[model samples]
Target: MLGGLWEWWRRRRLLVDASFAAPLLLLAVFYQGELDQGIYGFPGVGFLGYWALHAGLLLPLVWRRRWPRATFAIIALACFGQWLLHVPLMAGDVAVLYGLYTVTAYCSFRWSLAAVLVTLLGAVLEAAQLANLPREFRWAVMFLSAVCVGVWLLGLHMRTRRAYLRSLEERAERLERERGNELQVARAAERARIARELHDVVAHNVSVIVVQADGAAFTLDTDPDRARKALETISETGRTALAEMRRLVGVLRENAHESGDGYAPQPGVEQLAELVDQMHRSGLPVTLTVDGTPIEVSEGRQLTIFRVVQEALTNTLKHGGPRAAARVTVRYAPDAIEVRVSDDGRGAAAPDDGRGHGLVGMRERVAVYGGRVRAAPRPGGGFEVIARIPVREEART
Candidate 1:
């Protein structure tokens, strides 16, 4: 609280300068008679002139901070005029040092240097007026000169300190902005990861349940056994989805390590056969074919490949007609892996609301590996999904 008020007071520069000049103005009025009398016989414009000179010296100080060079020039001219007329120095003459300090603090180094030379010259010339008091003149002038130089030095120090503080404040603000941006980026990345997981879990499993339920409804009166099988598939798919939902909730609620791999390892090449078999049970015909020697890759890259294939096949099962068939092909190369899923169905003619994010999610996953995905309706009355993910040497399992 005190610091805040102190800063507030500093910002009221004009008010502060006025307060500084108040005491000097009072001294110039009441204390001029206390100094030694002038040498000239002529009073030189009488009492009003003295008051005017005193006001001129002090009043300009109110603008010292805003107009340092001008303020100092006006005050210095009045002080020199008073000295040339042999008006013995008064108490308010201290404003001369204050003006020099302002010039040093706010003006360029050149102006500050000139101010110091002028002040030192005035001090020597004033001391010479008291040449009869030789013992005190030298010391008094030396002391005055030292005070003037010291005040100038103090002003320079103040300028340097203010500049340093400003630099620190600027740096702090920059870091705060950068930190906020980084947090936004991290949150966006996390949201994307959660989105991909939800798509994989909910879309594929719910579609299976939906397909099986439809099948059971159609076969209920015609074939009891087929209906029973369809109902069982629906039940199984629902339970699997429920289990996955629980796992996702647990991962969100606890630390990843605390969950103890509760995220559940995602299916990769080893599970493709099972995926094919599962599709068969769902009444979709899919053929899985692998080309080139299988290369071991990290779980993350494997998961990427798996999601691409999973999204493609799920899309196929949902869109492909009862008689449509899909072919799954996995090709491996020295530097990359490709998964191609194509279905001979209604192709782009399939009824879609255009709200699906399956293909977009697949593209995002593949792009993270500096890869690409092409999902389009094939020319020959079919739809195709092709994903290629890079396999860096360091990605070996």
Candidate 2:
């Protein structure tokens, strides 16, 4: 119960109203007799007039935070009116100092400085009238000056502290928004990579299957043995394609909150020979050569190399004529690995507009490891794709 009441009292409106009322109640009880004495140089107003003036000075403070300039103006006018009428200072006069502090805290610095100057001048004028008591007048002016300056400085300190806290909150909010944007961009790039992986895996294997199936159909009656061999090759190609597709689909399923326990591992550099053999079985004879000692490569970089080679050969099989042949050369340099895929076929020029999705995917993959690729028609009569990928020494065993 006490805690609840304390929270209620801490509210601004309740606290302001209470501050206005408490002084009025205290003055009515303790200072009524002194006020009634009507000392010389003080206003000779009756009880009703004194109470009216006191209320006018203190009541405007209730809206000080909402209308700081207006409230301070009213309080200053009241103070000047009392001085003009020669009214004695009452307990409620402290509200003028509180009004000045509020104006400094809530209003702009120029307005607060203006209020300070006016209050200081009023204090000096009030002090001058008491020349008969020089010591008391000096002390009074010093005390009033100290109080006005101290309260205004305190209000300025509070304003600066509040502004610093607001800046910190705004900076935190902006950083959070930037972090959210970065996360969205990362997710989009991951999805695009996954799509490219699926396309390269499915397209290459299906094209081989179609070519082998057509060959088996054409030779079914004339050469039973050859047809049986072609059917066997198609079965193997279909199974490999199915396994790879399942792994890619499993990744998608895992991302969608499904089981991914049976997924296969991604192919890398070690599997390059198997890929070449598969192409050879599809009736596109290929020759692969390696130069210099092989060094250990990161799985991601190895995958990039494998995919580039796979896409290049797949394009050759799709576009190269029946009698075409391909040569794949890999050179391991001290600082980089270079690959060249050349085919002796009816080579056509690559599109100048860069609209080929397969080439785009290869470029994107190579770019991940700061590599470069070039695909164009050879000078004589073939298509060639060359890629060079940089390697870090620490990435090797």
Candidate 3:
């Protein structure tokens, strides 16, 4: 509530300043009226001059912040004229101090310094004007000079503080912009990764379904049992592909589940045996072997290994001939884990299409763990994919 009030006043400052100046003008007019009526021993100043002088002294204060230099100039001129014409003491003169403050805080110190000099000069002339006054009364000039310097210093302090606050606000804005940019980059990278996962899942599983469906169609009558088995493989492969899709899509969801059932966890190294068994049923005839003790790796690294093997064998299914067979070897080292997928198939005949992104995805995933992937045709025949994911020393078994 206080914050709202301060903001409201800030917007209407000109009206507030005018309101302050109105009271001062009224108070001075009352005193000037008494002085004009011979209520004191001082010489009577005319009503016209009194109104003219006091208005010039205080009314300009309304615009002191908006046009501080012009306001101070008008007030300083009237203040000097008040002394030259022997005007009686009025509260309107105090506006000069406020005008000087506005010039110091809103304008530069170099400009306010001249107002300080003029005020000092006025103090000396005021001392001279009250020459017959007592020593204690005359000492008021020193007090007035101190007040002038004190207000000037206060304005200077406010100016420095305001500048510092402005600089801090600008710095905060710059940091916010940088943070927004970083989030956009991270979001883009994540979307690209999800795209790669989708491609690998769909391409691999769809290829298995196509192979099984083609075999079932060819042997539907002559080999009824083999046809039934191929149809079963197709159904199971479709369900597996759907599960993989849900796992990937769950990453984008807020509730982490669909239809009141939790999504399946991601495929990892432990699931390799099941994956190989499914591939054998799909007519891909893949053999799996593991070497050395497995290390305790992060889920992301394990997913990297699984996806690399999946993409390599999927490519072999698409390009390897009917008689082809594949071997997947997982070698566990102290500092690294490796998956080498090689197929004894006619891999050299595979199209070198620049459109393929499976290898690209494999490289991107392994690169996250400071690892590398090598994919190329074997010396005599077939194709091989070796992805080595570095294991942190602490994760070594």
Candidate 4:
């Protein structure tokens, strides 16, 4: 209940306004009473008129923030009018200090400085008038001047602090937006990568299955034994495609199951021979040669090499003429691994705009390992793809 009441009080603007106005109103009343007792001589303004002026000076403070410059102007004018009439200063005159502070805190700096100067002049004038009075009251000008400067300084400090806090909040919001944008970009790149992997795995195997199925159907009556062999090749190709598809699907369903059963290790350079045999069965005569002793390679870099070779051979099968043949070479160096896949096909005649998805995927994969890839038509009649990937000793182990 107390928390609810506190929240209610905090939200009520009228209560806040009254909190400030009531105290000054009581001070004005007290000063009026003192004047009535003949403690400070008035300038012939009757009791009612003096009280009315004091009320005007003190009540406007309720709306000081709503109309800061206007409120300060009204209060300053009232104080100057009272001084011009030679009325004795009262405690109600202290409201001018609050007016100066409000203008500095809520209004622009130029207006606030203008109020400061005006208040300073008023203080000097009051001091000049009281200068010839008594020794005990001579400190009035210095005291009022100090109060005005101190209030303005406090208001300026508050304004600077509020601006600084606002800037910090804006900076935090900007960084959050940038972080969200970076995540979106990363997600998009990953999705594209998965699409390319699926394409490389499925397209190659499906193409071979289609070719073997056609061959089996064509030779079934004329050569029963050859037809049986083609059927067997089709079955093997389909199973390999299915296994790869399951692995790709598992990657897509990440975190869906914790058993790790759905995931399979990605193919690497060690599987290059099996890949070449598959292509040979698909009626593409392909050969692989290795130079230098084999070295341990990170799974990621190995995958990059495998994909480069797979994509090159897939392009050859799709676009290379029936008699096309391919050769793959891997050279291991102390600091790098190099792969080359070249096909003696009708590549120069194949229509390609150099923007095929397979080529783009190969480049993206190689770039992940800070590798360089080149794919271009050879001078005579074939297509060639070469990739060189740098390796770190730690990664090799």
Candidate 5:
């Protein structure tokens, strides 16, 4: 029951009505004589009469938090009227200190200061009249001024502390949001890398197997030896593709453990020979050329070049005619590496445009390492794909 009452006092509209009503309740319960002494002043009206007067004056205080200036004015007027009527001195008027503090914390600085000065001046004069001290009684007026001033300064400090706390909370919340965004960006980049690997592995290797298997079936009756060779090539190419794919995908598993020493090494340009052999055995006439000494490149750039070549060959097998032949050339330079893949096919002679996942994967790969790729029909004939990857002077590939 007491908890409920306390909650109501803290939250209800009755707080305004009961701000002074509470004191009146106490006065009625405790005060017995018409004129008496208690915790409050005496020698005039009894404690009950003085409390009644203060409660009536505080009727306006219910609105203090809402209308501070009006409440202050009302309280000041009540006190001045009591002095005029010669009512016994009452300490209940001390509630003005709290009301003044609220006004100082919420109102403009100048207005709050002016209100404090006016109230202190009135309090000093009232105290001097009510309590007749020795000749040094004037010193009491100064003491009253000091007490009111101290209360006003306390209110200012509380307001400053509250504002400081609010600023710190806002800074912490902003930092949390920034950290979340950075994590999301990192996740999105890793996912795109995985997708490119998947397309290169599945599409390129699968296309080669299909072509080789078809040739083996066609030659089984007429040429048993050639048929066996085609079947063998299909088996070898499929296994190599699966191995490469496993290496790339292992990083994606949540609990995947790296080698005790470090991460696995990535495949680079040296692996192109094995790739070309797979296409030759699939019955596509392919030419391979390397101009300068092979040099090392970053894992990301190496994988990108490898996938571009793989996709180009896959497209040739899928779209090139029966007699189509492909030529692949890798040229190393002082500051960059150039890769070219072209096929003398009679089918739609345009190199893979940005259409199927094959072409899309190639483009995404090239873009990641700051490389440029151009796929178009060769001016003479057939389709051609050209890629140039810029490298640091000290870097090699």
Candidate 6:
């Protein structure tokens, strides 16, 4: 039931305000003549007198949001004046009651309480003057007290309810934000774990294959049969890597492979040479350099570096001038690997369209590995892309 009401409120906020405002507008029109006649009570005061007094009191209510304290003060004075004159409580005075209640609910408690006390005092004085009762036994006084106290209490309750609803809304929003943050953290951690596993699989397999291929090629001149055997081993190793890659991808629920192990080998830092060789064959002037002995990296960091280099090369091919020269340098230190890719080409210094997903992808990769990327135009006139990946393998896991 509360949910339905909330939905209604959300869907029709303007409608509710309009419905309340229309009646107030109508009341204003009906009482306008009375107000014109009763300004300072000009000649004999009639029903017009009471209506005009209340018109002033209620007129300010239209601007209650702008001047709440002043509106309530006007209402309290009008109500007190009418009580003293024995005006028998005009129907228009009901608007003053609503105004007083609104003031109490929306304004400071001290202000609202002061208004309530003044109204009660006026009610007491009127009852004492008009009611035929002894000072000891005054039912009229009690009735007056009840009326004033009841309005005040009702307004206070409404204020409390409003405050409670506001608190609940703020709390719900805080919890929603916390949940979103937790989900994002969990997702990032999972990706890092998968990346680590993939790196281990790729590096170990690729390194072994490259070693055997080199040895077999060296023997090909003297021993043809052995060379053939070595070539077959290279083929088998390639097939195994491909098979593992497929198997791992199969776990993603895609129907790429009908049978056999679904895991596939994912490339890592070990495949840097292979990547450079492919780009070389594709007609780009590419060079690869390594500083310091290679150290083990978390699968996640390896993947991030591989992707960064791949993206840098891809951008060069798409944007660089013909026969552009590009170089990738990886400096492996004790704690981190700093990679720098620079290209001497015309398109290198041009601005990116800002729509390419590659930049976003690179950022996400670096963010996961607790790394940073800087892509800018070099002082010598070309584009340089640099990525630094920390080597906290345990932290990545």
Residue 23, candidate 2: Cα error in Å is 4.4
Lowest-scoring 10 consecutive residues by lDDT in candidate 6?
247-256
Model 3: worst 10 consecutive residues (lDDT sum): 253-262
lDDT string for model 6 (136-224, tens) is 33777788778778998999999999999999999989878976676565555444444445545655667768988888889989988
Sort the predicted structures by lDDT, highest score first: 4, 3, 1, 2, 6, 5
Compute the lDDT for candidate 2.
Answer: 0.76
Backbone atom clashes (below 3 Å) for every candidate: 0, 0, 0, 0, 0, 12
| Model 2, span 101-206: residue lDDT tens | 8888877899999989988987887677644588889998998899889988998988788889989999989888876676555545554565455546566667
lDDT of 4 by residue, 1-397 (tens): 9999999987886567658777777877787777779886787688886877787687778787778888888999899888888877776787888889888887789988999999999998888877776663458877878988999999899888888998999998997897667655555455456544554656677888899999999999999999999999899778667644643543332233344332244688999999999999999999999998999765556777998899899999989889999999999999999999999998779876433467666776676556889999999889999999887622321
lDDT (C-alpha) at residue 311 in model 3: 87
Please give the CA lDDT of all the candidate structures.
0.77, 0.76, 0.79, 0.80, 0.70, 0.70
- TM-scores, each model vs. reference: 0.51, 0.55, 0.53, 0.55, 0.45, 0.48
The residue ranges of model 3 lying beyond 4 angstroms of the native Cα positions read 1-10, 37-44, 132-141, 167-179, 206-224, 231-397
The TM-score of candidate 2 is: 0.55
TM-score of 3: 0.53
lDDT, candidate 5, equals 0.70
After superposition, the stretches of candidate 1 with alpha carbons farther than 4 Å from their true spots are 1-12, 33-45, 132-137, 199-228, 231-397
lDDT preference between candidates 1 and 6, better one: 1
How displaced is residue 239 in candidate 4, in Å? 9.9
* Candidate number that wins on lDDT, 3 or 4: 4
Sorted on TM-score, best first, the list reads 4, 2, 3, 1, 6, 5
Select the stronger candidate by TM-score from 3 and 4: 4
Q: Which stretches of candidate 5 lie over 4 Å from their true place?
A: 1-52, 60-69, 127-137, 196-397
